[model samples]
Each structure stands twice: as C-alpha cells, then as structure tokens.
Target chain A: MRLLREAAVIAGKDLRIEARSRVTTNQVLPFGGLVIVLFAMALDADRPTLTRVAPGLFWVTILLAASLAAARSAAVEIENGAADGLRMSSLDGASIFLGKAAAVAVQLVGLELVLGVAVVALYDVEVRSSPVMIVGALCATVGLAAAGTLFAALASGLRARETVLPLLLLPVLAPVLLGGTRAWEAGFEGTPSDGWPWVQLLALFGLVYGSLGVLAYGSLLEES
Target chain B: MLAGVDLDVVEGEIVLLSGPNGAGKTSLLRLLSGLLALTSGEANVLGHDLAVDRRSVRTQLALLGHDTFCYDDLSVVDNLRFAARAVGRSKHAAVEAADRAVERVGLARQAHLEHRRLSAGQKRRLSLGTALVRDARLLLLDEPHAGLDPEGRDVLDALVRDAASDGRTVVFSSHELDRARGLAGREVRIVAGEAHGGRFPTAAAASPTTSTSGSGSVSSAADEPVAGVSAARAGVDTEMAPGDAHEVSP
Candidate 1:
C-alpha cells in the first residue's frame, strides 16, 4: 500500500511536470507524426506497400518516440538536481521505477493514439481486429516503457546521455518492436487469429521488462 | 577519492565542513546522505548501517546540494509538496508541511510562481524549504549559502540554528568561514580527503577536542587562524552530555 502511494506520487509529479511543459505533446508528438509522414513519403505512390508496412511503420515511430519521451523524463530529474531529491526521498526504488514506467507508458499511449490515426489516414489501412490491436498496443507500451525507463536511468548522469540512450535502449527493445509489429500485422489481417500468440509474446515481454525494472532500479539508482 | 578519514558528529550539533575545492567535503557529505557508496568502510548513520541499510538512512535524512532540486515547470509550492510526499508524508501532512515550509522560508508570496521563474535566491530558499519540509533527522547541505542575499542568508542561519536547537543534526559544507564558524559547534577541515578536527570558540566551547577516531592529535596548524584545536586532548572530553559529542569511526 505504501509502495503504491509512493508510486502514485511519483507518477503524479512526473505527469504534472510533463503537462505543464507539454514536451511530449508539443515536441515528441509532432516528431512522431513527422516520422509517419516521412515513412509515407519514402514509400511514395505505393499505397498497397504502405498498407502492408503500416504496422511496422507505426511501431517504429512509437519506438523512436518512446526513446525521446524517456530521455525527456530523465532529463527533468536532472534539471535543478531533482535526481538528488529523488534519491534522498523516502520512496523506495521499486516505487520510483513503477512510477516512471507508468508515466512513460501514459506518454506513449498518447503518442500511439496520434500515430495510430495518422497511420490509418495515410496508409489507408483497415483495422479488422480492434481488440487484438488494443491488447497488443497495451502490452507493447508497457514493455517499451519499462525498458525505456530502465535504459534512461542507465544512461542518466553520463555526459553523452542523449546520444547514449537510444543506443542502449533500442537493442534491448528489439523484442518489443518485433512482437508489437507482428501482433499488429495479425490484427490488420482479415482473420486476425495468429495475432494472439504475438500478443502473448508482447505481454510476456512487458512482464519481463517490468519485473526487471522493479528489481534493478534500486541498484541502478545507486550508480553515481 | 577520500582515504583514511575518520570523523564523528553528534546529534543536534552543527558541524561545519570547511576545505578548499577538491577536498572531498562534498563527497563526504554525499556518503553520509547515502547518495555515494563507500568503497570499503563501515558507516552507521542514525542507527542505519550505510552498507546494508542505505534506504533507511536516506529516508531519515535530507540533502540540499549545489542544485536547487526544484522542477522548472512546477510551482514552488508544488515542488515542496512533492518533496514532502516523496519522503512518505501523507497527502494531508505533505500539504501542511509544504505550506508551513514555504512560509518559513518566506516564499509564500512566490509559492504559486513556476520554479523556473524564481530568482536564484528565491530558488535557493525554495530548495531549503523543501529540505525543511522533509523534517528528517539529519540535514546535509552542500554549499547552502551560495546564491542567497543577506536576508536569505540570515533566514538560512536561523533555520539551521533552529533545527539544531530542536535536536536535529546539521552537517553543511561552505567556504564562507565567518558565517559558518559562528553556527557550527565543531569544525572539521578536510585536506586531501583526511579530516582534521577543530573547536569553534564561539559555539560549543565547552567541548574543545576534535571528535574523529584514530587521529590522536591535531596538527600544529590547528593554532592557525581557524578555530581548530589539536586532537591530543580530544578523548579527555568524551564524557560530554548526550548529543554533545558525536564520535564515530569514519
């Protein structure tokens, strides 16, 4: 119960900061939207091809956006030495991890909504299985957020954090990208039967990373 | 980078850590605050072994470092409230504490202003208020007086003195000797990561010996302008009242 309360406070603080700054809404969202537009342009006049790759393109944009969101979240703590305040706070590390991951997930959900609409409008793709896509997105967002928060902490306090974050996060998040895209592909299909297995994979990925984040955050926070 | 440094601080005592830059004063404070790991040593703060119980140690202490520790987008009151909550205060308690702290630091007028919009001195006051809101047993401040005006400094001085009088321990590092020398019961000089004990004639004058372990005698330099005395007569005053002598093995 205490952990949950602390987590809520942390999440609340992060969300409040983000809301006031609108970094995710103003900057990262537009960046993700631009990525979708660029993907469409890159596959110019190939509507069928764009439709076939929409799921992959959507997941890729989310992955890129997740990196930025995670970095910005960590950067907020770095500003004005807020990281030290966090470390010195009575809140446990697990609570901190959960809170940060939840914030990232929330930001990603917003990004996903925008990107999803863009993909639908630009790729002219039809969603045959909304249920599978929602589940896939939920699970994939959790996995990305957990991994992103973990890697954000790993890269924080470094002189090259901005450059180093993607390098450390992307490789770890390959499973999320793969599982999410595959599940989305199945969801886009007429039958949408095979996506459940990929959805399960995404769920498994989320569970693994989430658990890893809770277990490792304490030690990660101790570093520097 | 610290080596062979042994120091002890007592409860309710204000210990000023003074040294030139790179003297490991900040590092020592960080270690005490559980923000830095000791490579190999035993550290027990507020009855929590730093090696094994860092979290508990951290929970019982508040550290105000060089940074303001305020979120730029959050209002000053929000920052204090968040800090209070972060330290496990209930929502009601956090709100009350934050309100009291803001007023205590004289930031009530600017409480609703975004932290980024605060002047440097206001930000410092807000940071100090955040530390005060935690109501921790130990307060470790690094350069707490850097950007404050005379009035702000006076407020800080009163806060530190008041905290100490209320039986809360304060360990602060500062290069401002005149201001710091007046507040600290004892002063520790860190040179090359090793600490030398000193006595503040104006404060805690009853206990004149240094409080560190394994260092038996204060160097001849103790007679210098600084308020330090040699450690040769240190153990003689071991019988001082509770909270008067903080003798620990650092």
Candidate 2:
C-alpha cells in the first residue's frame, strides 16, 4: 500500500510534467510513426510478406519506441536536478523505478496503439490473434522500459546522453526483444504452440529488469 | 519531534561540518536521512539502521540540499503539497506546514507562483520550506543560509532554535565561519576529507574585540580557547537548552 502511494505520487508528478512539456509525447509519436512507415516502405509494401513480418516488425518498432520513451523518462528527472529531491523523499528505489516505468509504459502503449492500427491498415495483416500478441508485447515492453529508464537515469547527467542511453540499454534489453518477437510471432500464427515459454521469458525479463533497476537506482542516483 | 543522528545529537549542542568544498557533508546528511545510500557505513538514525530499516529512517528525517527540489512548473503550494504527500503527511497538516514555512521565509505572497519564477535566494528558501513541510524529527540542511538576507537569517535562526527547543536535531553545513557560528548550536569543521576541530568565538582568540554578529572565529588547532565548549565532539544532545556552556574534553 505504501509502495503504491509512492509510485502514484512519483508517476503522477512525472506524467503531469510530461503532459505540460509535451516534449515526450510529441517526440515519441512522430519518431515511432516514422519508424513504422519506414518498415512498411522497406518491405516492398507486399501483403503476405508484410503480414508475415508484421509481428516482428511491430515488436521491433515497439521496442525502439519503448527504448526511446523510457530513456527520457528518468533523464528528465536527473537533468532538472529533481532526482536529488526524489532521492531525498521517502520513496524507495523500487517505487521510483516503478513510477518511471509506469509512465514510460503508458507512453509505449499509446505509441503501440497508433503503430498497431497503422500496421494492420497498411499491411493488411490479420490481428484476430492480436490480443495475445498485444499482451505479450506489453510484457516485453515493460521489461525494456523498466531497464531502459534505469540506464537512462544513470546516463542522463553524463555528456552525450543520447548516445549513451542506447549503448547501456540495448545490451540488457536483448532478451526482451528476442522473447517479444518470438511470442508475437507465435501469437500471430494462431496456434499457441510453445508461445507459453516465450511469454514466461517476458515475465522473467520483467522481474529481473525491475529488480535490478530497483536495487541499482539508488547507487546511480548517488553517483549522478 | 526530536530526531537523532546515527551518532547521538545531544541536547543544547551546536555541531558543525566545517570542511573544504566537496567533503561530502551534504552527501552524509542525505545518506543519514535515507536520501543517499550508505555505500559503506553503519548509520542507525533514530534507532533505524539504514541497511535494515531505511523506510523507518526515511519517515523520521528530512534532508535539504543545494538543489531546491521545487517543481519549476508547479506553484509553490503545489510543490509543498507533493512533498507532503510523499512523506505521508495529511493534506491539512501539509498546507499548514507550507503556510508557516513560506511565511517564515518571508515568501507568503509567492506561494501561488511557479518555482521557475522565483529568484535564486527565493529558490533556496523554497528548499528550506520544503524541508520544513516534512514535519520530520531530523532536519538535515545543506547551506541553509547561503542566500538569506539579515532579516531572513534571523527568521531562520529562530526557526532552528524553535525546532531544537522542540527536541528536533537540526544539522547543517556552511563555509562562512561567522555565519556558521550564528546558525549552528554546535559546529563540526571538516577539512579535506577529514573532520577538523571547532568552537565558538572567544574574546581572547583571533577576534577578541569582534562582536558576536560577524567576528572571524579562530578555527586553527593551534589557537585553542579556554571556553566551556568541547573540541571535535560527535553525537550531540538536542533537547538541552541553547547556550549551555560546559567544558568538553577532546
């Protein structure tokens, strides 16, 4: 209960700040849309190939979207020197990480919705099995988002933040990307064969990434 | 409302953290108050070890630092509200605390203004106000008087005294020796990475004729005075009345 309250306060404050600034949402939308369009253009705009690659393509776009969005979620707090204030507050590191991840997850969902609709319309891919795909993708996105925000916060105060975030995040987020694409592919094929294992991988990624983010966030904040 | 440090903060004690710049005084306070990690140290703040019971420690302490922590986009009152909620204070208590803190800092009229609209000095005062709103037992201030006017300083002094009188441990750091004397009940001086000795100004030392307001106190180890104050003591007693002079052995 206490953790929920802390997460709410931190996430609420951050979400409000993002809303007022519009920098986060604005950047996520256009960049994510552009990436989806590029995927469409690169795939020869064919129906079957687009359909076959749609799950993988959609997961890839979502991964990039989550990565970019999560990168700034904590970076803004550190950049403004507010991380010190947050540190000084009674909120623990897990609460802080969850709060940041929550906001980033929200942004990713919004981006995914836009990209999902566009991908289905443009590529004529069938998403009758998309509910499972969407859920699996979300799990993977949360894992990536949680881990990405931690690294972003770690790197935010450093020089060359834009270059450093992906460097630190991509290596750790490899599991999520692999599991997410696989899970989404299995779901798209509508057989549910061994998709459970990949889904479990996403869950494990979430737990490991979330726990590590929680434990290491304090040290990162202190170092910053 | 009494707050104790990992080491005791005795009553009627004025502790100083005198040191060259970047001696980790601010970081120490933050760590003790559960703001920064222990890294490697045994700190049992108010009987709560940071390693084992950080949540309890956090509930009992407040930390003030160079950064104001004010949300630049929000109104001053809203900023305080956020802090209050963070610490689990009631909304009414939070508002009351915010009002008193803002009024105490002479910024009552600016409570509704955005933080970015405030000046540097005003920003510092806002940080002080945020600490004030926590209603915590321990108050850890980093350069609390960095940008205060003389009147503002007096108000701050009174607030610190009131807090001490109520048995709250008030700890802060500063570079100005004169101002340090005026603000701290006891002072701890840190030089390089190590803590140096400290005491109040005496009539026969470096500035005998110097007034209590702004005299340069003798801080060197070579010029020790015969005052009732101690030399380089940790773990002060806060409930003791201010100005209780007593001879303390090093």
Candidate 3:
C-alpha cells in the first residue's frame, strides 16, 4: 500500500511534466504516425500487404516510439540533477522504479491507441478480436515500459545515451515485439485462441520485467 | 574521500564546514546524505548508523547540493509539493507545506511560475525551500551562500537561523568564512581532506561586532557561546583515518 502511494505520487509528477511539456504528444506521437505512414508509402500503398502486415508495422512503430518515451522519462530526472535528489530521497527505490515504468507505460499505451487506430485506417485492416488486442497491448506495454525505463537509467550516465538507449532497449525488446505482433495478428485473423499463447508470452515478459525492476532498482540506483 | 575528520555537532547547533575545492567536504556531505557508500569506516547521523540504516539517516536529513533539483517543466509550488510528497507527506499536507516553504523563501509572488522561468537566485531559493519542506531533523547544505544575490543570501541566512532556532541541526559548507561565522555556532576548516576545527577568535568578537545579525548566540540552538565549546564537537561527530580515507564515529 505504501509502495503504491509513493509510486502514484511519482507517476503523477512525471505525467504532470508530460502534460506540460507535451514531448510525448508533440514529438513522440507525431513520430509514431510518421513511421506508420512511411511503412505504408514504403509498401507502395499496397493495401493487401499493408493489411496483412499491419500488426508487425504497428508494434514496430510502438517499439521505436517507446524508445523516445523512455528517453523523455529519464531526461526528467537528470535535468537539474533531480536524479541525485531522487536517489537521496527517503522514498523506496522499488517504488521509484514502479512509478517511472508506469509513466512510460502510460505514455506508450496512449501512443499505441492512436497508432492502432492509424494502423486500422491506413492499412485497411479490420479488428476481428478486440479483447485479445487489448490484453496483448497491455502485456507488451508493461514489458516495453519496464525495460525501457530500466535500460534508460542504465545508459543515463553515458554521453551516447540518446543513441545507446534504442540499441540497448530495442534488442532486449525483441521478444515483446514478436509476441505483440503475433497476438495482434491472431486478433486480426479472427482466431482469438491462437493469440492467447502469444498473449501469455507477453504477459510473462511483463511479469519478468516488472519483478526484475522491483528487485534490482534499489541497487541500480545505489550504484548509479 | 575525507581523512582525519574528527568532528562533533550538538543538537540544534549549526556547524559550518569550510575547505578548499575537492577537499572531501562534498564527499562528507554525500556520505551524510546517504548518497555515497561507506568504503571503509562508519559514520552516524541522528542516531542512525550509515552502514546499517542509511535510509533512516536520509529520512532525518535534507541536502541542498550544487543543483537546485527543481524541474524546469513544473511550477515552483509543484516542485516543492513533489518533494514534500516524496518525503511521505499526504497530498493536503504537502500542498500546505509547499505554500509555506515558498512564502518563507520570499518567492510567494512567483509561486505559480515554472521553475525554468525563475532567476538563478530564485531557483536557489526554491531549492532551499525544498530542504525546509522536508521537515528533516538534520539539514545538510553544500556551499549554501555561493552565487546568491545579497537579498537571496539574506533570505537563506534567515531560514538557516530559523531552522537552528527551531532545534533542527544544520551542517553547511561555505567558502564565505566571514559570513559563515555569523550563521554557524562553530566553524571547522578542512585542508587536504583533513578536518581541523578552530575557534572564531571569540563569540563576542565574531558576534555582532564582527558580522551582522543572526550571529552565534541567537542562532546556536546549542545555546552555548561560540567559545563555550568546540563547534565541531557539538552535534555530529566522527574520527577519520588520514591516509586511507577511513571514517569512524563513536
């Protein structure tokens, strides 16, 4: 309960920053849209290929955008040396991890929604399975946000973090991208049962990332 | 990274740490703030042994380091409110505390402004206000007087004095020796990472006669005359190894 409250406060603070700065809204969101468009144009506006590959294209866009979201989250703390103050604050480290991950997850979830709609509209695809897509998206978002926040902090001290973050984050997020695409494909194919296994994979990924963050965040913070 | 740092501070007393750059003054403050790990020796603050219960020490202490730690996107009140909440205050209490902190820091007029819009001195004021809002038992300030306009310095001096008078212990480092003496009950000079504490001539000499208001007698919650006792021997105490950067407190 205490952890939840602390995490909520931190999440609230991060979200408030996002709301004011609109980095995710103005930059990340538009960037995600541009990727979907580029994918469409790259396919020569081929409707069948776009529809068949919508899940992959959509999840890939999210993966790239998640990198941007993670950087923004890390940037907030490092600005004005707020990260040092946060490290030295009395708040528990696990709570800080939960809070940061939740913030990134929230931003990605919002991005995924807009991008999902864009995928459906531009790719000429139909949503044959809403429930599966919802569950799968949540699972993928949790994993991506957790991994993104963790890796961002890991690479924060490096000078090449902006470039290094995506390199470190995307490779680790390969499973998430795979599971998410498969789950969405199952949804699109109208075979919800087929997506369940991939949904399970995504869920497991989220759980592992969340648990690792909770257990290791404190020490990571200490070392940083 | 400090050595031969034998020092003590009494409750409610203000101890000033003065030293050359890279002399481990910040290293010492970071250790007390629980931000740095103990490599060899142990130090205690507010009855919490750093190695065993660093979190407790952190809870009882607040640090205002070189960075203001204020977010550019957040308003001044929001920054202070976030800090208040971070320290376990309820939402309502945090609002009240943040309001009071800014008012005390003389930034009430710009309370709603984003932190990035504030002047350098105003940013420092907000930073000091965060420390005030922590309600911590021990206040750790690094070069608290550096870069402050005279007015900002006055506000900071007044707040430090107020904290001391309220029975909170304050340990701050400063290069402004003449002014530091005015706010500190005791002054300890660090040279080559070694803490060598000495008196400020005499309390009366360094008192109003030597400086301005908020001198030793009024601000020293220890209530001992500046010369009544050794300053570093007052509140927090430690005996550090000279050669190996080992620190131990009894």
Which candidate ranks first by DockQ, i.e. highest?
A: 1
* TM-score between model 1 and native: 0.87
Ranking by DockQ: 1, 3, 2
Q: For residues B1-250, could you state the per-residue lDDT of candidate 1 as single tens digits?
A: 3443556565677888887776666767776676766555455566555556667778787888888878999999899999999887889999999999998999989989999999999999998999999898678888899999999999999999999889777889899999999988778887655577632333343332123222211111111111111221122233333222333222
Q: For model 1, what is the alpha-carbon lDDT of residue B10?
A: 57
Which lDDT tens digits does candidate 2 get at residues B138-204?
Answer: 6777777788777767777787888878866666787777877876766655432233343333333
* Counted clashes in each candidate structure: 3, 22, 7
Q: Model-by-model lDDT, in order?
A: 0.79, 0.65, 0.79
Which should have the higher lDDT, number 1 or number 2? 1
In the predicted model 3, the residue pairs found to clash are: B8-B232, B8-B234, B9-B234, B9-B235, B9-B236, B10-B234, B10-B235
Docking category of candidate 3: medium
- Local error of candidate 1 at B200, Å? 10
For model 3, the stretches where C-alpha displacement exceeds 4 angstroms are B198-250
Interface RMSD of 3: 1.1
**Candidate 1, after superposition: displacement of residue B19 in Å?**
2.6
Please give the lDDT score at residue A156 for candidate 3: 83
Give the Å error, residue A137, model 3: 0.8
lDDT of 3 by residue, A29-142 (tens): 999999999998888557788788889999999999999999989888888999877876778989999999999999998999899999888888899888999999999999
Best by TM-score: 3
DockQ of each: 0.72, 0.35, 0.59
